[model samples]
Target: MLKHALLSLLLLITIHTSNAATPKGPLEILRHSLVQEVFAFGIRPQDTNWFDIEVSTNLTDWSRLATALSTNATAFFVDDSATNAPTRFYRLRIPGTTVAQQQAIWTELRRRTYTIQVERISSSGKYLSADVTVTSGAKHISNVKDPLTGEAVADFDPADFPSIEEIFTKLEAAAQTGIYDLRVWYDPKHGYPTRMIQREISGMNSNVTELRFNLVER
Candidate 1:
């Protein structure tokens, strides 16, 4: 009987030691500061396990940003449409896991995810300020420019050319009306454009010329 008890205690100690080595989930922020939108990417469970992405302004009263099952890589976006507050915090909650597993999950998540925040804009609207809040990331920003004039092109109208330059026109119009295009990019590195936000605006003026994007750092 004493031999059996010693074996059980040894097994318990082994299990505890193993549990202490697990990893946690990572917190990646796509947008932070001077911007209203945000994105978080992390490894979530597949189906059997469950996780919750929580956001808080005060870090006390937490709100659910998203909920998922298992630790599969996933991305989620949130807009401060309801409340325009500064400094938002986010965290992940994983149930039915050892602490070591949580740490490993977090490390992998950080490796794959990066957090960035838009800082400020340049005077001439040629360049913008980007501040890296975290580590392990890369960022680039470019725009459509007149080949001959070397100036940022801001002539195309969304209403006039809805087919060829539909996205650009819509965004330009939005910027003209005091609504900012927080996610429109023409990256020279990638040789393509991508839209991060899609919304309509009214009462735009035609004299609006330059558009600027401030990329946040990770």
Candidate 2:
């Protein structure tokens, strides 16, 4: 009887240690903004191809918002353009995973990169809201040609390509010359394009021109 009890105690100790080493999964709140909300959690990479995320004010009740996997997932919320709220909470649930894996996932997310730029139309109408000036790159323009017609492209007036004092001068110039806006926000670490906004110039019409760009580019 004494030997049996001693063996049982040792076995229990081993089991407890093993359990402690495993990870756990639980809800995580990523960000809260007036315009946007973000939440995320971990799911086993093997068990499910995607995660089912639910949001609710009260923990007892929930509503599905998004479904995604460990690598391909975006769990976020946005209020209607007209209506904005103050505070919100989010929750996540996944099977066959522990909370620790979820926490590790969040840590990985923090390493993602972000870039923000705010542009406004200037009070003056003659110039663009923002200007980008560019200098000649290492490769000079041998001869400008219209890619569409295979005809020699006319040189833009000096006013069209202003001198840039900073790195963004080239970008600003490109914007002014009606090249693809090419404005992009990216996460270099993951090689993911987070957001992009572009405008295409249709042609001169009275005083107004038209443009286009993708806000979300995968």
Query: lDDT values of the candidates?
Result: 0.34, 0.30
Model 2 sits at a Cα RMSD from the real structure of 21.4
Q: Pick by lDDT: which candidate is best?
A: 1
Question: What lDDT score goes with residue 76 in model 1?
Answer: 30
| Candidate 1 local lDDT, 41-147, one digit each (tens) | 23323223334445566657865444333222433334333244444555555542322333344344443333332222223343232323333433322343443
The positional error of residue 103 in candidate 2, measured at the CA in angstroms, is 30
Instruction: Name the lDDT of candidate 2.
Output: 0.30
Q: Put down candidate 2 lDDT per residue, 1-218, tens digits, no spaces.
A: 53432232220000111244563433343443331222222222221222333444434555544322232132333322212223233443343122233334434543222222212222233222122222232211223333344565455333332221221343334433434223233333432223323334345522222111111212
Q: What's the C-alpha lDDT at position 58 in model 1? A: 68
Q: Score residue 214 of candidate 2 by CA lDDT.
A: 16
Error of 1 at 49 (Å): 3.5
- Show the lowest summed lDDT stretch of 10 residues, model 2: 9-18
